[model samples]
Target: MASRRIPKAAGCSPIRAVLAGPAENVITEKLILKPAPETKTEVVQKNTSVHNDNWFELMAINHLSEKLQAATGVKSMKSGYESLVEATAMVSKIYNPKRQQELVIQCLDSAIPKIILNMIKTLLPQTQFTREYFAAFTTVFFTWLIGPSEVRESEFNGRREKNVVHVKKCRFLEQSNCVGMCINLCKMPSQAFIKDTLGMPVNMVPNFEDMSCEMIFGQEPPASNDDPALKQPCYKSCRAIQKHTAKCSS
Candidate 1:
């Protein structure tokens, strides 16, 4: 009881004690506790980096679409699908499949640059011409130019290869609905582009049943006589087949 008088309330609050200390130290401590401005900046930069190519992608698509239109003689972009098929049929009527392939190659050759070819050449050795590299390139480049496709990797011939690009529903095929057009226009030219131009062998297999197709990269194509793609019958929905009332053969 003698000292029962409670110790006077702490002479100063803890905050006051801190405030009473060196102003510079207090300011430094506050700054240390506060979040850095760069933290917010870094988050913004990361998001922007991922989305940096909007204009570039748009430009690329526009350029490719224009080239396709020019090559196919399709004046209107609105009717690109129909025009592409019509143009293919016209070409098929005028030229043999082999010649059609050469024309398509010439068109593509002009559009894609020597620099890109050189880059591919440089990277091909580094990548060992693996299926994954080619598949990735196809997805990023070809799909953007054409339509959607999926890359499926599997073991073949005693090696793992991401060699297949599965087009679940091809825009060209759906619009054309003709087996001959698929072979002459898309399949043959694509094979030639990949194999002869890009130096990667590929065989394009079109399945008309579901309007799906598989582009098998890194594989040699069979002879036309032995190829099932050559043997495919015209789709029931083919306009030519319907109009002519005739079956299509290789």
Candidate 2:
């Protein structure tokens, strides 16, 4: 004897809805499913690679390279890494510790709201005057431009805050390999840009041990005398320190 197979009900997906009753008694269940919206974290995680070929990044590098070259009388023979090193060396040569801070802040002020930042401003209309928004923005932007970073949320003054960005490894710092450059170029200028230009107070703390850094937004920086970054000795691998070992030693 041949066995008869049961027919599935109309408009019912066998995989989505299992039938336990006769075809006539089976409830026609329609499963309407959609892909979930991507969160900011998900979006950032997806874009892990640095967008080196992007026009915004290219323009920013050029603009900053030109400005640094002009300020320090150092020219960039090569793009990217070489330009960064040459510019940093020039900055070291042209200014004392005090003046280095000033020049870096000035250069950043003039250079920031750069193409990428401007695009961010235009894209994220709601990224104003909020620590959380800026933090999220930084996570995506920095991860795109620099490298991967972790965004952490915490409470401040009895309110939930998302203002801390932890850089597992700073590509620029690692490449430049100079404590002075980290302070004068990356740390100071970045803080100044976020605080002055973006109107959000921030303090950048670099950990020389692991080459990690923390960008704390919505926090005021301490005075020079009290700031740890100001007192950090030059990196052992610092080209400036090697070039002027006698002066640095004294």
Best by TM-score: 2
Measured with C-alpha atoms, the lDDT of residue 33 in candidate 2 is: 97
Top lDDT model:
2
lDDT of the structure predicted as candidate 1: 0.63
lDDT per residue for candidate 1 within 1-250, as digits (tens), equals 1222333466843332112444565543343466656543234223321112355555765565556557756454343334445555565555666766777777777778979976775667523346677776777766533467888876667877777888766666665556776787678787877766667887777766556677777778888889888887775457646653433444
- Give the C-alpha miss distance for residue 87 in model 2, angstroms: 0.6
| Per-residue C-alpha lDDT of model 2 across residues 1-250, encoded as one tens digit per residue | 2344456789964444344555696568899999999754334334433434467666667777777677656776888655766677666766665566676666665666477666654564433246777777777765533456888866667776777888876767666557777777677767776665556778888877666788877778887779887787765456666663322210
Q: List TM-scores for all candidates, in order.
A: 0.64, 0.66
Q: Which ten residues in a row have the lowest lDDT in candidate 2?
A: 241-250
- TM-score of candidate 1 relative to the true fold: 0.64
Model 1 misplaced stretches (Cα beyond 4 Å): 1-83, 126-129, 144-146, 240-250
